[model samples]
Target: ARAYRMEWPADMTVFEIDQPQVIEFKATTLAGLGAAPRAELCTVPIDLRQDWPKALLDAGLDRNRPIAWIAEGLFGYLPPAAQDRLLDNVTALSAHGSRLACEAVPDMSQVDHDQAREMMRRVTAKWREHGFDFEFADLGYEGERADVASYLDNLGWRTVGKPMSRLLADNGLAAIPQSNDSVSVADTVYYSATLSK
Candidate 1:
């Protein structure tokens, strides 16, 4: 599959395309709208939530080489068990010094089911109209989930950085007028964290 934002040279070996046309079009549009280093159209079957390291291993890609994996806007779609499973797979296939970057939706323990469903309804209007019918539970790492930082640290990764509310405020990000809980009962509990090996 083509790597977006990757820098390519004239002599660089290029791979074939294997993703959907819509994704390719979106990638190209993104590249056009932003200063992405370089991107190629590919013919890869893209599975955002798949066990990617296994896929690479099955494809004969070396597991010993450091790989950079990014999961954006995906953590919220998985259940807690699946989240752990995904992380386990990452640890299994990642060589020393491999890096991962992702955004997670944190826990939604405080949310009422009715509100959550209503929110989902509004968000999934298009899909629902297209015949989709499924309810989702909180799919992110609760700060309490096995002490995520420590778990990863034990797995050889280190807590590197995070954009906590205090950090954001220090960086001139104005605090919200009121507590997030007051604004939205379904608000998540934890700030995003970054970990690296």
Candidate 2:
């Protein structure tokens, strides 16, 4: 949606997909603001757990055209199997030159699950004090999950993984200080890859 607000070339079309409630909220808010999107924007309201490809196609997505797909802040919320399924669908729909960028969680094998859960509990409690009541631990699937970059590599995609610290520095930003509550910040990696096959 933010991309659509920017005045890009007319040939480019931006599509935003999300759950029905989120789509509804965005639509309503835009309507209330009377701010129209600058470029062609399509919003597809479909659950990720369901057939999203069909929904996207119905919304006028061109499967033959190359696309830049972003999966930021999403994979951790889904189980490992679901993540694989989503990638499979994406690979099937993507054209030869399509690109994919994602933020992936670090390997959890070395971390203590109990300690992680406790940390999340404290974070959740802090959020609850401000009005949001939700279990942060329950929101994510924590276990031995496939390394996203490796999975993409095996699927014939050329992958490049950048650690969060390096990424920040590359953008002329300082890295965050090391702290107990900063494990996630330190562990996250960003990936940018292109389909080669």
Candidate 3:
């Protein structure tokens, strides 16, 4: 960047990408609270399933520089193909040395459908009482899917994955109860990776 005379900001610009409605709501709420972020924050409103890489570039992301990407609580919300596309997009946009961290949910087909449905029923019922009723099962895709870590590994990312329970125990925290139930997240795997030069 210095060689090219790119006028990148002294402070790193953190981009937060999400749905248009979500971005709007967040902006409104933040304005209402007079909240301020410590760093330069750019909120990009675009559907992840669409041409988000272009949208992000338009929002001033510097692909020439290393980007630390986080896919927190994101993949399960998308269909398997969309999830794969998202990963591809991220990998394509990243420069060498760019790092990524994501929380990977198990393949939905491996989960207990009946148990998941019952759990969602109880949770959605409570939301309906509060006038915010929506079916996640309808929004979130469910079926067999490729493992995130393996997929990224094939794309040339040096990867490391650990279960949430293992992370907790390593941090000296009490472990969450392990279960085969869909609602239990103790076994959720988190992956961190870097694209090497």
Rate residue 125 of model 1 by lDDT. 71
Best model number under lDDT: 2
Candidate 3 per-residue lDDT over residues 36-132, each given as its tens digit: 6656778888887678899899989999999989898998788788888988889999999999999987656666788898777777888889998
Off by over 4 Å in 3: 1-10, 126-131, 178-183
For model 3, give the 10-residue run with minimal summed lDDT: 1-10
Among the numbered candidates, top TM-score falls to 2
Q: Write the per-residue lDDT of candidate 1 for residues 128-172, one digit (tens) a residue.
A: 788976543333233324444555666777655353454456789
Candidate with the larger lDDT of 1 and 3: 3
Candidate 2, number of clashes = 0
User: Per-prediction TM-score, please?
Assistant: 0.57, 0.92, 0.87
What is each predicted model's overall lDDT from 0 to 1? 0.52, 0.87, 0.82
Name model 1 segments beyond 4 Å from true: 1-44, 48-51, 58-60, 119-147, 160-164, 176-197
Pairs with steric clashes in candidate 2? none
TM-score of decoy 3: 0.87
- lDDT value for model 1: 0.52
Candidate 1: residue 193 lDDT (0-100)? 31
